[model samples]
Target chain A: MSASGKIVIALDGMGGDNAPAMVVAGADIARQRYPDATFLLFGDEARLRPMVDKTRWLKTACEIVAAADVVTNDDKPSAALRKRRSSSMGMAIDAVAEGKADCVVSAGNTGALLATATVGLRMLPGVRRPALCSFLPTVRGETAMLDLGANMQCDANNLVEFAVMGSVFAKSVLGIDAPTVGLLNVGAEEGKGNETLRDAAAMLRVEDSPVAFHGFVEGNDIGAGVVDVVVTDGFTGNVALKTIEGTAKLYTGFVRQAFKTSTLAKVGYVLASSAWKKLGQRADPRRYNGGVFLGLNGVCVKSHGGTDALGFANALGVAVDLVKYHFSDKVVEELNRLRQALGEVPAAAAGGVAGAG
Target chain B: MSASGKIVIALDGMGGDNAPAMVVAGADIARQRYPDATFLLFGDEARLRPMVDKTRWLKTACEIVAAADVVTNDDKPSAALRKRRSSSMGMAIDAVAEGKADCVVSAGNTGALLATATVGLRMLPGVRRPALCSFLPTVRGETAMLDLGANMQCDANNLVEFAVMGSVFAKSVLGIDAPTVGLLNVGAEEGKGNETLRDAAAMLRVEDSPVAFHGFVEGNDIGAGVVDVVVTDGFTGNVALKTIEGTAKLYTGFVRQAFKTSTLAKVGYVLASSAWKKLGQRADPRRYNGGVFLGLNGVCVKSHGGTDALGFANALGVAVDLVKYHFSDKVVEELNRLRQALGEVPAAAAGGVAGAG
Candidate 1:
């Protein structure tokens, strides 16, 4: 009966490669599946009406909140957010800040979305910077890799914050308590890699670590699932992310080609067609589409530029789940608690434990 | 007409992951395949005697250059080469330097192999750094990617030298005349990535580049076969190489799990078994095993650490082919000619190329 029982997710309609269409399609699916969910689509009134008309159920199920403009992926974040206050990304984040929505979602410029959420929704107490978190399917299980591309230049403090935020996100969202945090480096040995990673590893290994700090893990171990949370600077994280994406595409292409090269192979292909399709779907980036930029005050998701409708739907689904679980507030409260526990901050009233906006 | 019609490559009996056994196996295969080919196995008299005994026909067919000790993978290159002067790696390189063997083959420590070859056989004139080159199989075909993990930190000059040596190796050995060289960066744009890559990209675009410089390429394009040669520093290259290996392993594993999930899947699995196996073999690192450290005075090939007989054999095969074409000399001459043509060096005769060593 209350809004708390039904997640209110504000979708940035003018974001992503297929923008309003994908956003409307995803909303349509979500509304059809979950009656309790309410989506407030933010964008230009004229463009969205045509898109929502196709969805056929937005009149009663979802609302289109008119916004002045949209943020282009190529524009600088600070400049775009400053120039266009009513931009979809900014409006969606504002909705969360104003208590009109529990979470904000954007497939727009990742940097702009992150900046808007950080500035608009306001970070949880004691959380210096928000980090992006996503799952990397490793041999053991899915491990959360953080700061996927949030801060380009991270110091020891930044990494510590990332570890705390990532750990909290993994625990609250993925249902994993005390997730093992690892410092991603060129090697597993303690002192291997660039200065930043080495310093971060040392900071993470402290007895008072906010999370379960594991020793260093190598690039290969990311897929092997050696640790639950892998933390690194955005530069390396971006490269690692793209590298994995490229490799997956390459392997899938090679496998398809290999199967098509022979006459007998064609017969085998028909037999294994369903199985192969499932394998292809499993490897599909759409299933794990949106990469959340955590540490910010609000929930923001960045989808791949090449994402299809399924990917858009997955992004929306993640947003809905995150809002319903009150993911942002949980992360902030966990970090503040850890900070106070570690004597980094004075004991605050109510212990800063609060629900998501 | 003998099977040894081409240049004779000597194998170090005490080198590689499966030394003696793998070394002997590869040599036997090479000898049987190439009627004119001969292998000079070198190692400890006691340990190698049994391995030699097993291949008695290979004994008369291939020569044994006796050495007393072995070089461990973890040993420091300079210290190992200095203290163990009669070690298998040192002696193997000496054979080439002395003209008793055209090239030395070893799957031992890459650092040790590189050091021995650089110190013992000497580097070509004007070559500041040697690159480890490997064939990266792309969708179009196999392209050469160099500096896989030889020089860890490289300057602009070192990258230029790497480009020239890599171009020559790919052209002379792989038969790609005037190979198109691409500088590997985070993005394809000229000004993308960090300072090192941007500077290297500029250096590569100059008129003095010995090969056909095709500007920049991303990690994805490395195996897309868009360029004949992809050049980068050892650190990034190593990461890229391992990422590809890890992804392939992960994808294949996923496929296996998918097939084993159900009886219907099992039926499909059996039907597609041959196609899957063919795909695995084609993507196998063994078939494209061995990385050649170009710019060394003599050819030094570094096989994978996990290599078996087949992979080792591929390394030996590469070494023999390199020697037959006098790969090192061509690189040396090209460097000298480029230096003179670019007015970076005084006019020198063809014989003066040896002085660069």
Candidate 2:
């Protein structure tokens, strides 16, 4: 925030399928909600200037910073961070790290974005690794799932950290005061999973634990809206998340095919277009575009790489909401509560805010 | 099969939600498909005789065997196998081991049924563990996935065994020649997944491998019909399977809600009733009831415990198909080919067919 009460955002240009144009246009849409917000955009000056010039309020609100390098999808995360500090994604994150902006938004390669942000803005104290949390509309309402591929393999301790992170996310972003958290397992029974899951369950079962633990839940529970926060290792979480998206696609394809079978069916589809339109909104991937990177020192939102401008705008909205919620501080408080419940306090001198310079 | 050309089947009459009535009624329906089949029904004769008498041909087709005990849902699988040998499930599997029946069908406890059948009927020569394979309808056609909750943690070799078993399943049951088998992973790239998956892929990539290896596939690939057979460890496979089921249900619920929003939609729904009926058939879970136990000495099918006679009959149908296809023998052939592809043949003296006495 500035002296005049403006929210400053750092934009990663030259990221995603449609880069500078989508980034600039999305910023324009987002500023309508946060009129006092300004953008410190990073990308090629030549490529970004025209896109910025076309927007009404954007031209006055944006400042474009030129960066020659770019992060490709194939580059390994750690390698990308060590090598591409001058890249657009890196510079955008640097603005946040420097406290030049309150948050950063990028539709870049997910691994690169995660790596760069983790290295530049860094992690909050007492957090081992950051988790990627996203939402999907369930039967009851929207449910949040965490570690959506940030850490492929997580142990018992790592899982507990993720649970705390997810709890804070459910509270801050999803607006749930006391969100129920469930450990993803193969079966609902207590004795169903491996040692790590059992150990994690034991930890979460504590009476004063940070989260309201709902015990173990199976794969079906994710869509059944069984819990507000579904926690698991990144590998399983990623698989389940993608599986849900694929299934939604498959079911939509089936419905479309069913409606195309005959003229009467087609007429019925048109006559009931309003109802189907409501469904279209329900299943729209664009509505859930932002994946919040939890436990970071600053707000960093990862937009879906292939999403359109509207999706990009939604990502900006997410970053703004996260900024309003002070997500990182909430995470630290939750972690403290969790540590207290576990009968110990986090180590001293590491500091509760940023652990690194 | 006997000299009279009848396919002998063993039925666990005291299994599943509906018990003896569902079991007997299902047998009658299955007999209509395979008119040359007879059942050795295992349960109390007092209860089975009345149901057999209700159907015209069931009385002539079924011979009720008095098994005094029954296996309950909560019993641990191995413990149940040891203690309940005279139970209906045990007696039914016993018929197959004794070669008095060609195969068995049980809608009992999945773990108990898998345990009893594996122990009683035994594994084919060179098989370490048996996998449970099931089918789901896809965009291209039906795709088979194995280790659907059988082996929770699979080694590289275990996964390879599953691949060969799944390949055989695709050929014998799904009727695909030289089926393209895919190993499930977090990403499609060769570098993705853990060591077990990478090692399994290396083995499957052998030029003379039994299955046509499609490399790595993501969770979405299962519903996308990207390959003929999808092979994964039981834990991940179970979660993905249930997730798919959950997603379909969620989508169906959303569609129903959409259609109910307006009177015009209700009218259109009635007018396009036939199309919706076809869609209903496509989505019917009973249409895909049976989960086949692969690499077992003889065929065994696990019907969903909650299913009605129709679903039970579908499972019976699956067993008959496996019998006609000579599934176990085909699995042996596939395993032999895989062994050849792997360079060193399996050690001798295990016998070529059934491993147990």
Find the candidate with the highest lDDT and give its number.
2
Q: Classify candidate 1 by CAPRI docking class.
A: acceptable
Model 1 misses residue A325 by how many Å? 4.7
Each model's TM-score for chain A is 0.89, 0.93
lDDT tens readout by residue for model 1, B1-357 = 124466677677887778878788777776766656677778876777677678744665777767877888778777767844688888888887877777778888877888778888777777878788898777776788878777666887787788887787787667887898888765675656667777777766656556688987777786567888888877667666766677677887887776776676677667766778878887888988978888877777777766887788788778767776767777777777666666777664645555666
Best by TM-score: 2
Alpha carbon lDDT of each predicted model: 0.74, 0.87
What's the TM-score, to 2 decimals, of chain B in model 2?
0.94
Q: RMSD in Å for candidate 1, one decimal? A: 4.6
- Compared with the real two-chain complex, what DockQ does model 1 have? 0.39
What's the TM-score, to 2 decimals, of chain B in model 1? 0.90
Give stretches of model 1 more than 4 Å off. A1-6, A32-36, A53-58, A73-82, A97-100, A111-132, A147-157, A324-357, B1-8, B34-37, B74-82, B97-100, B111-123, B333-357
DockQ of each: 0.39, 0.73
TM-score of chain A of 1: 0.89
